[model samples]
Structure formats: structure tokens, C-alpha cells
Target chain A: MTDRQLKIIEIVKQSGPITSEQIATLLSVTRATLRPDLAILTMSGILDARPKVGYFYVGIDENNLIAKKLRSKKVEDLMSLPVVVGEEATVYDTIVTIFLEDTGSVFVTDGGFLTGVVSRKDLLKNAIGGIDINKIPVGIIMTRRPNIVMAFPDENISDVARKIIEHEVDSVPVVEHVKREDGKEGYKILGKISKINIARFFVELAGE
Target chain B: MTDRQLKIIEIVKQSGPITSEQIATLLSVTRATLRPDLAILTMSGILDARPKVGYFYVGIDENNLIAKKLRSKKVEDLMSLPVVVGEEATVYDTIVTIFLEDTGSVFVTDGGFLTGVVSRKDLLKNAIGGIDINKIPVGIIMTRRPNIVMAFPDENISDVARKIIEHEVDSVPVVEHVKREDGKEGYKILGKISKINIARFFVELAGE
Candidate 1:
């Protein structure tokens, strides 16, 4: 909605059962110009109007509005591609890929199948342990599948945000179920939902 | 200010030169109770008033309001303790320090004098190079002084935010000038400003 429409919603919310004439006067706009805004609001269930009683508020709870917006939004609307590396890739090469992508984590995959995930913390842990990064395969140190937190396209974005907070993880891979040639069920990585993404979304949609 | 006061500001911003009678009625409060809120707005220069014309909006440029808030705020108001490690400490120990603290970077200090900064990326680079983390001092691999992005207590938080964004680093160490025992000027580490801090500040202050 445009700023003007948002303003109209605020007006009706603060003082419902107010006549269009009164609202128009308060906004310094003509009734004809406000007609469209009123219609859109009424049609969208944000407002209710009567011939004699005029406009009344019928909007969602304003206090939890941001939370509601987040919950209603699907993950697919905001998911982005995940940084990935082959399972056979050495820890040294994985480090290069991570810095090159400028991400906190990368997915370890084997023949396009989801396998494991490695994060900056994981790499730091390995580095601190006096391990040979060049010789060790990243898959050996990665958080294996079944332990990795993930999300589906149809899941609520708010749930994804909760997962990030609860797990204290940077990102969760977006995945989908796939059937292997042998008929066993497996998952395929599609995208990721990062803390940065959620933070940015909250900033953009919460207030102005 | 309370959310109610914020709402009052929004009301005046959208439809300024509006009468107190209208605002009080819309907010479902008495004009007597709104007196304090009005006074605060007028005192803050966020609103201007006239005897007959009512209240008028006289605030910062709306487009740059958020940026202005961040710029005008002191780093001291938002800083958190810097995660630190001794300069003589091994890269292996630095890795342990980083993971234990759950921070992406740590300050390398020698006798309380600001020396260098070691980040996850730095450790990863060392790891990839097949260096002996347990033997190499972090000071040897750290981003030396004059290369590290820093903030002072008097510096703008917005400037710190910009540094993080421009440099693509996780955090900036907050530092201040101090006199050494030998009478030379030196820098002392105070705290840090991170991306999460900025994001939380934005959420708390904007549009609430």
C-alpha cells in the first residue's frame, strides 16, 4: 500500500465511526479523492463502512502487526541460494569458497544430495585443534545431515526466524524432498534463510 | 518516549496543523493528559505550534531520519565489551577464544596497548596455508594496527555501521587514546560495535 493508504488506515484506527467528510477535512483532501482509498480499505477488510454510521475500524491487531506479517509470509518469498561445496572438497578449498562467498556457512553436498553443513565456528574449531586443513575433507568435520536445521518452501518465515534464534545458527538451508532412483527418500538443498536476511526483512517491514 | 508518544508524532506528521482537540479525541485521551506529550514534542523541535493554527511538523528530513539518528548517537551508548586475546597467544588458542566467546573476531593486545585484530577469515587463511596454529602467535597473523577499523567513544554509531558495511567485517573495536608510561600516546581498547547491535538498535528505535 502507498503511504497515503497507510495513513488512512492509521486515521480510521485511531478514530473509527468517523464520517468520510470528517476524515477528508482532517487529511485536507476532497471526499472524491478519498473514495478510492476507502474502497480499497473496506474491500481488504481493514475497514467497515455504513451509509449512516460512516467508517469504522476492522483492522488486525496493531501491536502484533509485524509479527503477524512475518508469520503469514512464506519462506519461498525470501529464500536465496545457499553457498555449496562438494563433500570431497578439502577443508582448505572450503575455506576459500567461504571467504569468496562472504558467508558464514556452506553446505556440503555429494552428487547433488544434501549431506552436511560447515560454519565459520566449525572451521575455527578445526583451526584451533591443530588439524591439517589441506588434507582433511570438509565432510568429515561438517555437521552431518539429520543434525542440520532446515526449512521448507511452504513453511512460515517466522518459524524460520525462530529456528535461527533457537539454534543460534547463522542460516538454515531450504530443502525439498526428492525420490532417489532406488526409491529411497532424500532431500535436496534449494536455498537458505540467514539471520541477516531476517534482520533486513524486519527492518524493511516493521515500521516505515 | 512511549509508543503512545510515538503514535502522537506520527499523527502530527501525517496531518499536521491539526488541533489538539482532534488528536486527543482520536487517541481516546483527554487534552489534559496529552499536554505532557505535546510539550515533549515541541521541546524536541519535532513539532511547532501556533495559538490558532494548531501543531505543525518541523522535524528532520524524513528520508534521512534513520541515518540521522544513527549518526547522532554516540558509540558509547551502544558498545559492548570487546572479545580479546593476548598478542603472544597461539593461533590455536585464538581459535578456542573465538569459539568460546562465539564472536567472529578477537582483539590482539600486548600490555593493554591496541595491537591487531584476528578474525575468522584470518584463522581460515592460516588453516588453509597448512600453518601450525599451535605454534604461531596470533599477533603474527592479525591485521596490524592502522589497518583495523575502529571507533571512538565520541564517534558516531552510524559511522561505525558504515565501516562495517563498507569493509564487510563483523565488528569494529572501540578504542580511545591514552598516555603510556613512557609518555607516548597510545590507543586502548574499549569495546566493539557489531552488525547485530546496529540491527537491534534500528528495530527498537524505528517506527515503534
Candidate 2:
């Protein structure tokens, strides 16, 4: 739908039972053009049209609406499969996986649980000037030593995006090995969240 | 570095002045076979060598140690620039951006400030199915409402990760619209976080 159509819907929601003629006048569109919009909205389940009357808001299926609008309700729906590495991994081993997998960072784990995170920056920083990549262990260059960015798969992307951006960081590590209150880890490493993910969901959609 | 090398480093770091034969005994390699391994590690700067005593642990450096084994550091040293998206969008638009960018999600914002986030699932569920993608206002499909995943640019990635897990999210959104303490809004989206990013850093330098 075009921006005008959305605007029309918003207007209708704000002022329902509005006549097509009234809408056309407000939007500077002809009544004929308004008819097509009304039809489109009706077909798309956004509105209910009546002859010799006006358009009323079409109540969405609560289930459908919830599924669409609430990320908190379904944040893990689109997460990718999870894969992790250990902190004890050698630089060569880490490099092979990173290059082969087309990934930018790797989560370092201990006993199947997240211990820390390492990114290209970490590797490059060590490799570029002072440290040599071949012999060094991953333990010395990690950004997670004093702190770590982490995620539990059950979360929504908005919360995750806020963390990455707020800290000026990239990805987070998944710690499925940790025991939960029920003696089970809350979630697994479903996938990685990125700025790109947010952009695809919001920016691109908004543009269209 | 493979798991094999990582073990070697751990053994040395924990117990230095160890011979290649002794290292091989623990790593399932023969003393003769471990010669190349020892050579490779020593040349890489992860280990120090002596003429007759044995090989010892090289001081920890970015290149020589594993990330998880290292002391945690700030994210500023690891995170990259942020990626952002506009607030208004359609489902179709979102699909195009997501596939094009290869990012997991995008940051949702208005006038350069982050408002919230929307994921692929957010678009698929909200914009697809019965919802009119072209007309429905994306502002309504925001996930993790009210900018829950908040972060400051100067903060560390580790700090952000901890909060992400604590907040139970896949990623965090970066913002710069700071409002005075008067309950006004002042925040802009700068970037995002994901497990992939953190995971990538921990890998060895061989791959990107």
C-alpha cells in the first residue's frame, strides 16, 4: 500500500464511519479513486465498506494481529540456527571456522556454555600490530573477559538491537549450558541478531 | 588454531617448561609428530622456546591467546559502526532489505533516532497473511516496545552483552537521542547487536 493509503487508514481509525467523498476531499483524491482504495482495504481486511454509507474500521483477528505486532510475544520466530565455539579454541581453528562460515564473530564457550565473545576486530587487533595470530590463544584478546554481550534465545529483537547499538557492539553469545531455576537452560542459540535484521524488518518494510 | 593447538596453549599456560613430548602425551600426538606443532605455535608468538629446558607459555597477547581465556575488556575495542533503518515500512519492503543486506534485522527509527525494532518474523507476521502490507502503519508492529534494549556508544560490548542476557534479548539497538531529565525524548539509532557478531570475534584470524 502507498503512504497515502496508510495515512487514510490512520485517519479512518482516528475518525471512523467516514464517507469516501469526505476522504477524497481530505486527500485531494477523486471519489472514483477513493472507491478503489476502499475496495483494496476491504479486500485486505483493513476496513468494511457499505453502500450509500461510509467505511468502518475492520477489526483484525486478535490472534493474527498479535502475531504481527508483538515482538515481545514472538521474538524467536525468525532466529537462525545456532553454532558456537570454545574459548580454548586455537586461533587457526577459530579462523578456519570464521572464514568458512562467513561469520564476523565467534562465541567462545566453556563446557558448552558461553564464556565470552570475539569479533573480527578482536582478531585483527591482535593480528595487525602487536600480537601474532598463529600462536596466541583466544583467551588474551577477548572483549568478554571483564564483560560479555550475551543473549538468551527467548528474547525479542528490539531489546537485543538496543543492547548492540547502545554499547556500540556487534553480536552477542548464547549460553545454553547454564542451568536455569528449573535445572534447564532457558533457551538455545537460535540465531544472531544484527542491525541488518532490524533494518530489514523495519526500514525496508517502511520504504515499501 | 584448532582445538589441538588450544589444548597445547592451555597446558603451557597452566604448566610451562613442558617438552613437546610431554605436550604430545596429553594431546594424543607423538613427540616426533608434535615437533611441527611446537614449531608452528612457537613461531606464532603464543609460546616461548628454550634451547634445552623446554617450551614455555608466551605472555598472553591478542594474537596468542583465546578470547574466553583472556581478561574481559570493553566493547569499544571490538564493536563496529552501527547500521540503522527508518521507522516506517511495509512487509514487502522489509523482505527486500533483509535478503539484500544479509543482516538478521534492522534498527527502526524516525528522523535518525531509534524508536524500536522489527524483525523478519515481525514483518512476516505483521505485514503478511491478512494484514495489508501496503497500508498498515509499521509503527504499530514494533517489537520490544519503548526501546527496551538501550545502550550508550561509549560503553563496552561485554557490558552490553550482559544486559542483553539480563534483559533476555537477541540483540541491542544503539541510540543517540538523549533527552534531559525532563521526560523528553532524545535518541537516535546508531547500530545493533547479534550473536553472530560476538561469535565471529572469538574465531581465529584465518577467516574474516
Candidate 3:
């Protein structure tokens, strides 16, 4: 945060429940300059302001605020496009897919719908055996649907982090429910969220 | 940053060349409460203060601030313990070591000195080639030193981040020169800094 932001916080702590007009008068700044600062402070939960009342100190336990921010965040806020491979792709093809993407896992899809998931460990186990990698379809060995953990765009980010850590998986496909042409329900893969994304988010937060 | 902190920045921007006493009186806050905030703002380069003049606006563009912060941060601030394995350890053993530590890379050491580094990609590549995992030592395939990018404790974090991205490696081992019992010079492994560490540090900054 900037120095001005820090000072604003200190003032609120000392004199809040205080009004923006009072704050502006004291800081010798016009409401115009304080507008953005106040908006950011309130939006970030550093200050709580009421319509008729005024701005007030939100307390310090910034870690709590950060956790709350993460909890309320949606999957779409951080999701990245999933690296996918067709279900019919061969194990050798899957190896190429893994290397090309440089990812630990890939979603197996059939016509843009998620069907299963394959990871490096699964492919490595296959490669260690004497089987013909070129002839074996990855779908035959993938973790099939109904077993895969997923998130919708609107789901909480905290829940997504839980799924990744709990499942001991590198990435989770973010899928949305859609009606098929035949009137059947199916999931359309939109993106993926990995531990790296979470870490990056945390880094961004620290900068704030 | 808190609301008061934001106010301070605004005040400095609008009235800079303003004094601490004037800031304290305007905000009705004690000098004690404002002390730490000023120090952090100055230290982070968010505000430049002159001895008799006072604090002034440093401008927006937080990316610049964050980059500066990263560039000056020491490796010790971001380091974690190195996950190590003996140089003679077999590829199969290295696989087990990778799983146990759950790290993307491991340092190959001999007699407590750095030797080489191995990553998951290396092991996966080896596993896919149908090699004798049990008999082949990982040292044979490891990225040997002079090739391995490392950081000293005092090295800048931005430099570390650059090395990792440039080398396309997941992490860098932090090392320091030391004297051996036999009065010979050697290097000592101190810790490891990975992409995750960088992310976590960023998150912490946002919270502050």
C-alpha cells in the first residue's frame, strides 16, 4: 500500500466513526482526491462506512481480511484455460501433450466436454510398463467422470483451494452445466485452477 | 493499507511539503501511532521525506513499487529449506524422494556440499524412456553445477525470480561460501526459493 493509504488508515483508527468531509478537512485535501482512496479502503474491507453515518476503523488482523477476500472470491476470478486432450488421444500422444503444456495434469474432453482427467503419475506408470504407448488411449486409464472434482464459475475460491489440496491434485477443471441438443445435461469445461494460481493471487494481494 | 494510511498519502499528495506535526494535528493521531506508518512508507519508497521539508507524493504505479520491493528483498526473506538427496541416489529413489518432499525439484548433494539439481521433468523424462530406474543414479542425468543457478543470502529476490524464469527451473538453491574443517573453502546449502515462495511473499505484501 502507498504511504497516503497507510496514513488514512491511521486517522480512521484514531477518529472513526468519522465522516469523509471531516477527513478531507483535516487532511487539507478535497473530497475529489479522497474519493478513490476511500473507495479502495472500503472495498478492501479496511474501513467500514455507512450511508448516513460515516467511515470507521475495521480493526487490524489483516490476515483475517485476506482470508475473507479469498473466501468470497469466485472461481472465474482466478481460473485459467484448461490444457485439454481429446479422450481418444493415445498415451504416447498424452505424453507429448504433457510435455508441450508443461503441466502436471490434463483434462480429458470429448467434444469440449470434460470426460476425465490424466496426470503425469498415471502416464509414468504406463510408460514404465512394456505396453505400446501408441496403441493405448489415455481415456482407458483416466479418472472418469463422477469421480472428478470440479468448480463452477460462481463457486467460492476457498472451496476450490480445498479441493486441490484434499484431492492431492495439481489442477481442477472449472466446468459449467449445459443442456445438450438431445435435452441431456452435461458439463462444459471452461477453465482450470491450480496451486500456482492460488500462489500468484496471494502474491498480488501482498503487493496491495 | 488501513483508511488512515490512505489519508496520509492523500494528505502528502495534496499538501506535501507538510510536516508530521501538521499531519498528526490534522488527523488527531499521536506521533507514536504515525511513526511506524511513516517509516514503512519511506522505506518502501512510496514517499520521499526531506529533513526539514517533509513527506511528498511518490506517485501511483504500484507495479513499480512492487518491483522495487522485490529487487531489494534478500534471499533470506524468501528462502525455505532445501529438499536434498545424495548424489548416488538411484532414479527410483529420487522418485520416492520427490513424492516424500512434494517439491518440484531436489538438490543433489555430496558430503553436505552442492553437486547437482533434479526436477520432476527430468525424472518423468527418465521414467518414460524405459531406463533401469533402480540401477541408474540420478546424478547421471542431473543438471550439474555451473549450470545450476543459485542465490546467495544477500541476493535480490527479483534477481532470483529472473534466474528461475530464465532457466525455466522451478526453484533455486540458496547457498553460501564456508570454510571446511580441513581449512578448505566450500559452499553450504542454506535454503530454497520457489515460485510458491514468491507468490506467498506477494500475498503478505498486499495484506500489509
lDDT of every model, 2 decimals:
0.78, 0.58, 0.79
Over B1-208, each residue of candidate 2 has an lDDT whose tens digit, in order, gives 4457667878997888987878888887788877766666665455888977888986423321223122233444555555455666765565556556755566666755576676544553443235666666566676644747776667655556556555545567755666656666757665566544443332211121
Fold similarity of candidate 2's chain A to the true chain A, as a TM-score: 0.59
lDDT of 3 by residue, A63-178 (tens): 44345455667889999878899988999999888898888789998876789998877776677666788899999989999999898899876677766756767678999999
Model 3 misplaced stretches (Cα beyond 4 Å): A1-61, A71-73, B1-82, B100-102, B130-135, B149-168, B183-186, B190-208
Interface RMSD of each: 10.8, 27.7, 8.6
Q: Which candidate order results from sorting by TM-score in descending order? A: 3, 1, 2
Candidate 1: which pairs clash?
Answer: none
Query: Per-residue lDDT tens digits of candidate 1, residues A12-111?
Result: 8789888999999999999999998887666545688998998998863343434334466788988888999999998878888888898989998887
Candidate achieving higher DockQ, 1 or 2? 1
True contacts kept of 2: 0.00
Q: Against the native chain B, what TM-score does each candidate's chain B reach?
A: 0.70, 0.56, 0.70
Supply the TM-score for candidate 3: 0.61
Taking all chains together, each candidate's TM-score versus the true structure is: 0.60, 0.36, 0.61
Please give the TM-score that candidate 1 achieves against the real structure: 0.60
Task: List native contact recovery per candidate, as a fraction of 1.
Answer: 0.09, 0.00, 0.09
Model 2: CA > 4 A from native: A1-70, A180-190, A203-208, B1-208
lDDT of 1 by residue, B29-71 (tens): 9999999778766654567899988998885333333333345
- Ordered from best to worst DockQ, the candidate numbers read 3, 1, 2
